[model samples]
Target: MKKTFFSFLTFFIFSFSAFAQNSVADEIKTLSKNKWQWMADKDVDKLDKLFDEQAMFVHMGGSWGKTREIEIIKSGFIHYKKADIHEVFSPIIIDNTVILLNRITLLAVVGTNEVSNPFMVTEVYVKVNNEWKMGSLSFSKLMGLN
Candidate 1:
């Protein structure tokens, strides 16, 4: 009886753990989609709450911190007019951090130039105080873009 009960308990625990991880992964994916919309709309308030205070952002122009990123968005320096997301791969979780990849064709207005380019964006989210906040965002431009 003891052996059977222990085996059942172990199986239950493993199943529950897997379910929880899947739930968190789905939530992270939804958050990433919402973030793209927020950027396209230039909604800094929402972005501020989603981004960690020490978050870093990398772009074709240069790399910057949270404050500079927010400033750029608010000032419309690089307006994220649209993001045509092609794919969002599964989020990989390690400890309290999640790393996600998003492939997209981005339409933006830089200064006075409007351009559309293909990019693979890497987003890293870290759990803080039971809330997930973006820790890093980097964009790598790709060739053969439509």
Candidate 2:
């Protein structure tokens, strides 16, 4: 009887933990989508809340902190015209950190040229004061035209 109860308790605990993680993952995914939209729209207000103070953004050209990222978006240095999200893979959750990987076709204007490219975007979120804030964003270009 004790063995059965212990097994059930363990199963319950793990199930609850997984459920919580899934919930948070879904929230993060939604936030990621919203972030892309905000970037396309050049909505710095929303982006400001989503990004952590010390967030880092890595691109093919260069990497910079949250301030520079927001400034770039605001200044139209690299406009995110669209993000055609192909798929959002399952998130990796470790304690207060979550890492989300998304495959997408990004349309943007760099200087005076418009370009489209496929990329795997890695987004890292960390929980701070009971809120999730994006800490890092890295885009890896994919080969071939899609």
Per-candidate TM-score against the hidden true structure: 0.96, 0.95
Residue 59 of model 1, lDDT score? 96
CA shift of 105, model 1, Å: 0.6
Clashing residue pairs for model 2: none
How far out, in Å, is residue 48 in model 2? 0.8
Regions more than 4 Å wrong, model 2: none
- Name the lDDT value of residue 45 in candidate 1: 100
Worst lDDT 10-window in candidate 1 = 137-146
lDDT of 2 by residue, 1-146 (tens): 99999999999999999899889989999989999999999999999998999999999999999999999999998999999999999999999999999999999999889999999999999999998999999999999857
TM accuracy, model 2: 0.95
